[model samples]
Target: MFILGISALYHDSAAALIKDGEIIAAAQEERFTRKKHDLSVPINAIAYCLKEAGIDVGQLDAVAFYDNPILTMERFLDNLVFAAKTDDTDDLMKFSYDSIFGTKLWIHKELEQALGGLGKLGKLLVAEHHISHAASAFYPSPFEDAAVITMDGVGEWATTTIGYGNKEDLKILRQINYPHSIGLLYSAFTYFCGFKVNSGDYKLMGLAPYGKPVYYDLIKERLINIKPDGSYRLNLEYFDYQYGRAMTNEKFAELFGGERRYPESAITKREMDMAASAQKVVEEVLILTAKTAKEITRSKNLVMAGGVALNCVANGKLLKEKIFDNIWIQPAAGDAGGALGCAFYAYYQYYGKKRVIGISDSQKGSYLGPAFSDEEIVKFLSQNEYPYEKFESAEMFYQKISALLQDEKVIGLCQGRMEYGPRALGNRSILGNPRSESMQSQINLKIKYRESFRPFAPSVLKETVLDYFELDGESPYMLFCANVQEHLRKEFSLDSLLDASNMDMLPVVNQARSEIPAVTHVDYSARIQTVDEERNPEYYRILRQLQKDTGYAVIINTSFNVRGEPIVCTPEDAYRCFMRTGMDVLVLNHMILYKEQQPEFVEWEDWRKSYELD
Candidate 1:
């Protein structure tokens, strides 16, 4: 049976198509639209999925939308009815509901029109938002049963949910409602700290180590009440997300004892302290919640998804706590993963398929998206008359790339299948030598143009993970952080960790605190991705070659894109990013193009404007 799943009208919109029990394709709308966190209906992604699967709309046995539109609409109206009487928020409530129903709920009609007016396929079987999130967490996990937790900003009605899944079914045991959301509280702080609400939450998390968690108590007492059972309730008086447009207002600033930090202005000690304090609090609450889930479910394995699950620091803490024997996090833990969620639910929950899940429920190792063939690569280069060289054999290709990385040259490595999640893995990635301490700063500031504090991750060979990190087994998703190994501690100067108790100076020494010091955080931990040959043979081959040459089992791997853009998807996108950035070599399949051989790149003032021109 063919099943098409869609999640849109929310941020990080996406589509996934599954045939039988395997994921045929999955992609986020932002990749095609060239918009970061695009919220529009995933029309482009849907088309891509169908194209990849070589199917038209009529061939699909079922279409599943991520959330129940009627249920969400009911929650929206109910919120409006209560807010109209208590908080004078009728107009804003109407706008929010209207936006969802008007744009997102009507996706079926949009698809029908796109598919040559095929109206019968428009009747999508719907799943609840949290249900989809739970499915996305558990179904692909390498476990027979697992405790599943999904926490995010308001989704239909549930902001947080905890459940347990065994084979084909998931039992949701508890939920936390809206307005009292952990995500909304963090978003409020994100806005107050001069960052975009949903997207900038990570930026705040990354900035945490630069300061102190001094405001933890103050925030707990005044803004949020953390319960013994891991649930939380926000003091609505301090937050304005329920009423007007802005996430935070003057009242929130006064409670925090400052006005909002202005963007592009120098970050101060107070701002860093606030970020650190909030992040610590978030960790504490998430840990408590995870413990609660473990106790209630009594399950040895745990799986998690939702935007909040993207916090690798909290994920690391959960691992260290040893509440569960094993944990699996959806790589696309954000809203984009809702597509996978819906697809899994449609196959298992609705159709009642006798759960014959494979080693990987997703295909190409969750690298289930578009890939350019050697011919396509050549075609694009030849079309543009781009200067390039070609390699006929895999051994020669790996040798050339390894040599470039050994020379500390940044290489754009786009090989094999594109990953389904936010992480680039080895494919659609920018690679550099991790041994150079300055490489981190150079890539962050000069190439990516993102914040220096936003650290990169190491893609280490699975067999050698324990040598460099405190982790065992595979961290394919790059979701959990582990300390640099004890043996390597001296090399990283764990012995001479400088005393910079003054919060203001923390950012200065962040780079000095850990071994694998480039990927390591101030806390001496790294969110690792362990590459296995069974799942990704080509990527494994590359890492093996690098290890034989450099005596290190790891290399720096970050998504191939500049700031304010989605991860590079197409050959054209890869070429543009490579030419514009400090990336020295561009390897699109077998064709290798040097930056100096290419024509000067003219970056579009607006990517959308550039697309329109094409």
Candidate 2:
């Protein structure tokens, strides 16, 4: 059976193709379109998936969308009606009306147009938003039967949902509906701290370790009423997302001192404190929720999907609490993974197909995106008259890259299929020596062209994962953070190195916290991606060779592109990003190109203007 599943008309639009319940190909529309979080129908992504599957549009047995349009329209109507009663939202009503009547009502039409006349022949399946999220979490997981939880800003009427998946039967046991969302509560802090809502939440997470949670008590007293069992309700009077254009209202700003911080402004103590407080609240809520999931479902395993599942800090805390014996998180846990979930929902649940569990997972390491051949890469290099070197064997190639990395030379690596999730994994990643004290600042300022305080993650060999970090098992998708091993950490006071009066974080970010300082955050925690041979053979070999040459197996890994740019999806995209940044080497498949050997590069327009900053 062939199924094409889609998540579109919202952020992170994507398409996934599956054959006989096995994922064949999947890619986000942003990769092809060069737009960050493209919300249109994933036409380009769908075309790529079909071509990769060696099928035409006619071969699709059923096309599934991630959510129901009618249900979504109902939610919008409910919110709009409530807004009219309390706020001056006449203009919002007109915009919301056009947005729903104009686009949400035409999802089927958009799919037909996107598929190029498939409406006449193909069966269209629509799953509830949380059902799509739950299926994505449970079906691809290694667990046979597990408790499932999905939490996000809003999905139709559901904001948070708890479910149980046994064999092919997936049931929604309970739910908390709209306006009382934990995701939105955190997002409100993201907005107030001078960051974009969905795009800037990670920045807030990164900033939390710098400040004390001074407002934890205040937030508990006013903003929310979180119970011992993890259920909570928001103090809606302080938020504006239901009716106003902003995430928070005047009442919210008054609680936090005053005014939302303007974008690109100087960092302050208030933003840091708010970030810390919000993070503490999120962790407490997740731990309590996991306890509830354990008691209700009485399942030893837990699987999670949804935007809130992307909180690695909270994930690590929950893991430490040992709320479940086994835990699995969807790498693309946001809306993009909804495509995978809806497809699984249709195949196993709708078609009544027998379920088969995977040894690790059925996601194929989430490396189901398009990959280019050496021949195609050669053609691009030859056409552009660029210079390069080729390695004949894997042995010499791995050794050569390891040596470059040891000397603190940054490498842009694009190998195999691109990752389907937001994370780079190893295929689309920037490589650097984590032992170098200045490497993090160099990569942040010169390569990524982003903030200085943001920390890098480590791609450590799976065999030596426990040697470097306090992890019980592997973290293949870079979804969790734990403290770097105590012995590897330095006895340094982070505050002693700081200028107490000035709020500049660069001085503090540069302070060495561990033996592998570049990947270590201010709090000594590292977001880790453990490289294993089974899932990522080539990346595994590279890290193994590095360990043989150096005492440590850990190396810095960040996404292959600069800030605001999507991770590179093509050889051309990789090369352009290489030329535009401070990276020293470009590795595409088996070919290696040095920066000094390439032709002089120029862009017609300022490359900085190419992408809108997240």
Candidate 3:
């Protein structure tokens, strides 16, 4: 049976296709639309999934939406009614009425329209938001039975859920509903710290290691009341999300001794402290939640999904605590992943299909998106009059690229299928030599055109993971941070360390903390992606070749796009990004292009204005 799953109308809208209980294709709408976190119905992504599946909409046996629109509308109504009691209801009521009566109430009609007149479409299924998240975590995981947890901003009424999945069935034992969300609590600080809420939460996470968590007590006392069992309630007086458009109210700013930081402003010690405090609270909640999940389910394994699960620092702490014998996180743990979860939920729970466990996972390394053939790439290159060269074989291609990387030359490596998650992985990555002291600054400033404080990730060979990082298992999705092995770290002078300020740490960040300086963060932790031959043989082979030449098995890896742009989707997109950036090499499958050999790119003004800053 063929099933199509969709998550839309919120950020990271996406579509997924499943055939006979196997995920065939999945992609976020942003990828095709070239809009960061595009929230429109995933029309282009759905088309891509159908094309990848070699089936039309008529071939689908079921269509599963990630959440129940009616339930979501009910929650919105509840919040609006509460707002009426405490605050001015004019604008809030108008927005809520328009949202529910205008759009949410007509989701089925919208789906029919999106599906191009749903005449041939089969059964339409709707799963609860958190249930969809739970299914996405447990179904694709290698565990037969595991404790499951999902946490995010308000999803219908539920913001967090704890459950257990056994074989083909799953059960939600408990939940924390909207207006008392850990996700929203963190996002509040994200907003106050000069970052966009849903998207900039990670930036807050990245900034945490720089400051002391002195405000943790203040947050616990004033903002949220977290319990020992991980259940919590927010002190609504300090937050405005329930009644107003803003996340935090005047009381919140007063408690924090300031107003919200304006976006793109200079970093301050207060922002850093708030970030660190928020991060500490988040980690504490996660750990408590995991412990409760283990206690209730008595499961040896744990599976996690939802946007909060994407916090690598918190995930690393969970791994270190070892509350469960094993843990598996959905690569696309955010709302985009809800598409996959809903589809699988319909397959196993709704259709009564048997679950089939895998040795690793059923996500195919999350490389379940479009891949262009060499012929198609060649046609585009020829049509565009772009200069390039084709390698003799895959072995020779990686060998040459590996040699180029050793020279500290940055390569825009676009090969195989695009990744289904926010992470770039090897399939859609810009790679550089991690050993170079200047590589990090160069890529961030010249190539990516992003904040200098953002750290790069390391893609290390699986066999040599322990040789470089303090991790022993797989991290295929770049979802965990492990310290560089003690032996591999370099000792820094006291003066160099003392000169690093809380507000401006670039001088200290530039100092090599480990053998691989480019990928190492200021705290010496590296967000790790361990590459195994079985999962990604081509990327692994390149790492092996680099190891053979440079005697190090790590490479700096970041998404293959400039700031605010989605990762390149096609050969044309790749070439345009290549010419726009200062990348030294462009590897499109077997074809390679050097920057010096290409003709001058003339559309700088228009191209620079194309992508809006996130």
> TM-score of every model?
0.93, 0.98, 0.97
* Worst-scoring 10-residue span by lDDT in model 3: 493-502
**Residue-level lDDT tens digits of model 3 in 1-614:** 88888998777999999988899999999999999999888999999999998888888888888988899888877887888786666666655667667876676778788896542444478899999999999999999999999999989999989999999999899999988999999999999998888988889988887667999999999888999999999999898888747899899999989899999888777887899899999999999999999999999999999999999999998999989989999999999999999999999988899998988889888999999999999999898788898988878887898889988899999999999989999989999999999888899889999877789999999989999899868899999998998887888652346345535656666778788999888778999999998888889999999999889999999999998899888888888899999999999988999999998888837776888766
Better of 2 and 3 by TM-score: 2
| Cα distance off (Å), candidate 1, residue 391 | 1.4
Q: Give the number of the best model, judged by TM-score.
A: 2
Query: Model 2, residue 430: displacement in angstroms?
Result: 0.5
| Residue 560 in candidate 2, Cα distance off native in Å | 0.9
List of clashing residue pairs for candidate 1: none
Q: Using lDDT as the measure, which candidate wins?
A: 2
User: Considering lDDT, which of the candidate structures 1 and 3 is the better prediction for this target?
Assistant: 3
Q: Number of backbone collisions per candidate, in order?
A: 0, 0, 0
What is candidate 1's CA lDDT for residue 341?
A: 89
Residue pair clashes in candidate 2: none
RMSD of each: 3.1, 1.2, 1.6
Q: lDDT by residue for model 1 over 477-583, one digit each (tens)?
A: 78877888876753433223333533333345345544456777666677789998987888899899998888888989998988777888999889988877778
